[model samples]
Target: MALFTNIARIQDGLLLCSDSDEEADYTKYQNYAKQLFQKLEAMEQKIDKFSIEESEFTYHYYIANGVCYLGFFKKNYPYRAVFAYLKELEEEFRRIYNQQEIEEANRSFTFIKFESVIRNLRQKYTDDSSLADKNIQQLSENLTDVQRIITKNIKEVLERGEKLETLNLASSKLSNESKVYAIKARNFKWRMWWKTYSPLIIIAAIVFLVLFIKFFIW
Candidate 1:
């Protein structure tokens, strides 16, 4: 059975930190949500909806009115229900709070009151009987396959960090190798110059010594 783990509201990439009783780690989920928000921001065109899949949970996010509503659900959770929940949350949030208040709030979980709202919604959506509910059934019917849309595996996400670390290490090693090669080439050039010119230098010294002795003796 898929569970509703968490919900959040983000604006302009900043999470409106709110107090929550949900079992999922808020800090970790917040970081994941921020990464998703950044990906959306990077796109030239705005995307109103997207999903990211992690090992334990899949995230469904909705963007509206400059605020992002993010939800964490079990992998098999119905995405349509998840989205409908987000939409309801978004609408309710907008109804209760103005844009200026949402934007100006700097404290974490500033909207702690919403936690109860989420709990209530989660119960309604997660219940088996809710599947037969007209609203949920309609939502499920209207939506496309959640698995097919913009899904990212948790392993791939972790591997990306590992790959970046590997690239940095490789780059540092290559830079050090180049520096060592340059120093060796300079030393080799000096040694070759010494070998090529030593005899000529010795001959010149001998010739000068002979010229001095002859001038003095004569």
Candidate 2:
């Protein structure tokens, strides 16, 4: 929750600062930054949805695809990699939160995680300093692709974040409308039932009167 809040604050702050500033680069950077935070916010929402909070101290987050449980991480997992991936997932989530987004990120976060894994691989390569140029080239190419995506999608993602905000509002309105309609329908049904059964009740009374007259008057 705090994580989500922090991301939201950062997102809002970047937007506010961007609005106040006059510099183009700074504005663009702020836009990207806001987009980044929006992505994080979206990721938090997804985690909350598919996740089951295991009491106040822990939570089990299910991955979107395969519905695989990520296991219960204690309230605060210290692995930077985990947080980073979550953060990246949020980024991806912001870009696409629809079914398409969810499906894509189900696979996309793998690449995001792969970014870290490849970084570790590169480090290992440097440590021994004996890895071939071919492997290096492959890793470099993959990394380039990842960066290109992040760069291009920051704006695309910010747009998605905006859509999420709109969606939330629309969802709230639709829910309220449904509730009101339900109440009206229930009231209408109650009235109709009364109207239909009231005649039967009157007929029963008239039949009872006729039976009493036949027995007593004759």
lDDT of each: 0.55, 0.33
lDDT of 1 by residue, 10-97 (tens): 4446556333345555567656656655444433134556667777677666667667777776666555455556666777778878
- Tell me the deviation in Å of residue 166 in model 2: 3.1
Q: What is the lDDT of residue 55 in candidate 2?
A: 29
Per-prediction tally of clashes? 4, 1
User: What range of 10 consecutive residues in model 2 has the weakest lDDT sum?
Assistant: 14-23
Cα deviation of 143 in candidate 1 (Å)? Answer: 5.0
lDDT for model 2: 0.33
lDDT of 2 by residue, 1-218 (tens): 11211122221222210011122223343334444443434443433222222223222222333222122233432222222333334444344334443334322133232233333422332332122334323333432211110112334435555433222111223223324433433455566678889999899999999999999987
**Candidates' TM-scores?**
0.55, 0.23
Displacement of residue 61 (Cα, Å) in model 1 is: 0.5
